[model samples]
Target: MDEQVITGTTAAEIAASVRALHERGALRRGDALPPVRELAAQLQVNRNTAVAAYRLLAQAGVVVARGRAGTVIAGVEAVAQEGYAADSVLRDVGTGNPDPGRIPDLSSALARATGRPVLYGEPVIDPALEARALAWVRDDLPDPELRITVTNGAVDAVERLLAQALLRDDAVALEDPCFLASIHTVRHGGYRAVPVPVDAEGMTVDGLRAALDAGVRAIICTPRAQNPTGATLSPARAAALRALLADHPYVLVIEDDHFSMLSQRPYETLIGPGHRRFALVRSVSKFLGPDMCLAIAATDPETADRLAFRLSPGTTWVSHILQRLVLAQLTDGTVLREVADAGRHYASQNAAFAARLTERGLPAEAGDGLNLWVALPVEARIVAERLMRRGWLARTGDEFLLGAHPAPSHHLRLTVHDLTAEEAARLVDDLVEAAGRSAPRS
Candidate 1:
């Protein structure tokens, strides 16, 4: 260890070393650093010098001290980079957000919804929004007889729904590498996440059956554009899921149709007629403006009643003002027009990028959602690491997988919905390079 000497002669040298560590972004808030003794030994510095450096760093507001948590990174998210490229690409291929330009425009009509000042404690449910949102999810949910509830967002709705339905340690089945929010929700609530396998055809019914057999109390399945995968559940596959859930009457099936309005593919009904307990959660966040954090959930009357109770107790309900805003846009002819435009923009961007990939000999294709899933011949982790070097971040299929044995398929979930033509082309080229680099180095 003495052979690897890191001498710090002057105060500037110690300051430079500390600054270098801070610049790397690894040493962030709430993250503990090596003990002064350990670091001094590593850097071959005097213990007093190490203490001085720590003190200097602390004074800079770069980190804070907690008894056990130690020094952590502060003011990180606010720090801006040179171009949006490394940070969020001022042009494209970053932020992983749906194209705001293409979101259903509410500009002309939203003003009318704000006509009246919204009164708190009044029935927060916007009947107009409910009527409109119901139509949006009509194809995938129960008959007109079923009840619907409005929520702040699909995320908020899912959290409330899971809370209402499951107790701690209760088993819930989710697609392997499911949506990040769902995964976090399950963990936050201390619920055991049961993994269900998803292939090109979406979630496998057989895997779901196995999870249920293992005594999962609830199942949350994404029918189409299965988040990172962009694999739509085929009608046949949906039917299989229905039969599996039908056999387990007590298991609550929560189908997340977050991509509803934006997805071009025909919707698949995983919660079949015979399936009694189910909730179809749909959010406008992806297709519509995120500022309008609204979701329309259609479920059986009993489940709706329970969810209402969860949303109730106090006046914690969906805002009528926000709902009215959404309803105004929805009822007007504007949304359908925006939906068409958004769909075209998304399909075109994804298709162009996929075509670029295919040209570079990486087989890729456009899927229904705001993203596309590309499968490489090699492992995705290897490919993703190489991509990280080129300032590209991607959600891997592993994040969505729900199985035990490591059937590692090399796939990347890429969001091209906001990518410009040139950016898309460059991304495809970079991806092909990364894919090549990931090849086994035997």
Candidate 2:
């Protein structure tokens, strides 16, 4: 990577030149570019122009800024994703998915969802769905002036909310050991993620205050059924968070209550009555099935208006048919009962597995949502490797982590609710054996 490879006067022109060079294979991954001052001097451009050019490159994923190490060409890093790996031979406990058998069948509801075809320029939300969705969230959210907007899913809602409220490189607070999609969304959107540590009680107050003091413009919180950790916000914790956030009334708060219907715990909210900007997103994927791909956002009027801008009349609105389908299933008494049964099934299975682990001399607890977050005595990667050898694919805790911690995470997030009795027993035996293998000999 020679300094001569970079050329052009303005920021866009300089960015284009670097892109062209990369396209031609002159600038390879990890190859460092000239320092801002040096590049400005060589190109005879303003220092700000050089900085802007690098910024563009970074935003485009063509380069990464390594602080004082300087800017370098970025590798095509594969982002972590949810669900099972394709063509995996092992029994995959890594998939963070709801048990498919328990998902309420939508075939019966499809007919009820259909009627007169919706046209462009009509209301974006299905009238009935809107009513039901509002009723669904009305009791939980503090804002009486809440408005509902539909999107592709919880991830889409989060992406749009952040896009509407903040600019690129603006800091956003995310829970440490965050959801996979949220992590991907913030990074892909080029926002700086300020990690707030999460514990059994949910996001730590001190951690969030630190993020706020660091000038984070927005906060994305999972009020209940937090992924990976499966930690829910207690009433007291939520109240404390709300009290802390009361002073920062203007900062945008987006609560992702993804496991709304299936969660066994009570819903706790961080949005206080007077908070100016907030959105509570609830996706139907957990109980309705992932392919349903719909979520409702109940938000403040101003945030709703900003979110509506991205969900244009014809092009971006969620399909009316899908919304109707969701409404039909939600309103069905039998389906609701089945959903409740599924919730109990998951809770029981996770509880049974935790008990087995405890009986095996490894203490564990079943938390809310679809997965169990088990703390291991040894390094998670070491245990994971041993599990792999025993024909199990496990999701290690470190994968969900953001920022640096005092020590490496020695935990595993296992989705064992879907496993059979025999399979569950085998997994426990394997896990105990794996942990033993990770121990040092005298």
Candidate 3:
């Protein structure tokens, strides 16, 4: 076999070769590629071409740039959330999806959205939706110069928001156990992910200050319902973070309020009165359903203008139909009631499960989100395997880790909102048994 794994001249050709290598098992995750200069000399191509090739690979999440460590195959690839294994006989509690039964019908809203055809050069954001979104966003954000722009969803909004503000190789502060989409977006855009640990109150003050000191140009935070952990920013924590960020006003701070109206916790923000370069994104997916595919991004006027350039006429404006549909659901009393009910349902179900886990002597914390973050008394992977044997599939916390070669985590993020009372009780028992079985005897 040839030791020369990468072989191509052009950037596209080189990227394709790397992808081929990855697919064939020739390139495993975390395997470092040859240095840019070395690979260029080997391929007889210019150094710039090799650099471009690596850049493309990084952008596709096939590779990652580790600063002084050079590039390596991505430990966590950017793809859709992993769901149940097809043909598996286990009940899947790993999928982070809202209950289909609870998602409100949008037939009436869709019917009303059929009025007009949006043409090129028309306003990218619908006027009525903008007005409503502006009022809604303003009620929460303390910054008065905020502007609203709608995107496909929370992920798209964050991607564009980061792109508008930072360049490739720039450091972006991310929660340690972050949302998968945010993780993927950062990795795919070829940006460095600075781990900011999150406590129960939200992002830790020391973590934020350290990231800032490390020269992070941007910070992506989840104000509420932080995925995987279900942590929300407490008012005191938010105030402290806001105070710290006031000194570094130019660092682009993005707060993804993906849970938004669905969260039981009150909305707290880190963007202070005069803080510049910030974005507050709220997606309709949690309440309206993932298929709704629309999110409102409220950002500073300058960031909004840069985002607008990317969303210009022939570029990537979110569909007007989806925007109108979200607006209709937001304005409709019956739909709003259904959404509110769904939110309560999620909270109640998670709380009940957390209580059961605690009663069983396993500490579990249920925060404001669709999933329950349960700490295991043993390794999460072993407990997950035990659950699989008992016909319950679960998501281990290791999958959400940011740093390289992190210590094994003992938490599992379970989506138990759709489970019945009997089912929930059965799951709790199984989880308790599984944890006990996986625990090493003292």
TM-score of each: 0.75, 0.94, 0.85
lDDT for each residue of candidate 3 in 255-295, tens digit (9 for 90 to 100): 99998888899988888887889899998888888878899
| Best prediction by TM-score | 2
**lDDT per model vs. reference:** 0.72, 0.91, 0.87
- In model 1, the worst 10-residue window by lDDT is 76-85
In candidate 2, which residue ranges exceed 4 Å CA deviation? 56-62, 74-76, 437-442
Better of 2 and 3 by TM-score: 2
Error of 2 at 118 (Å): 1.0
Q: Using lDDT as the measure, name the better of candidate 1 and candidate 2.
A: 2
Model 3: residues >4 Å from true position, as ranges?
1-87, 404-406, 437-442
Worst 10 residues of 3 by lDDT: 76-85
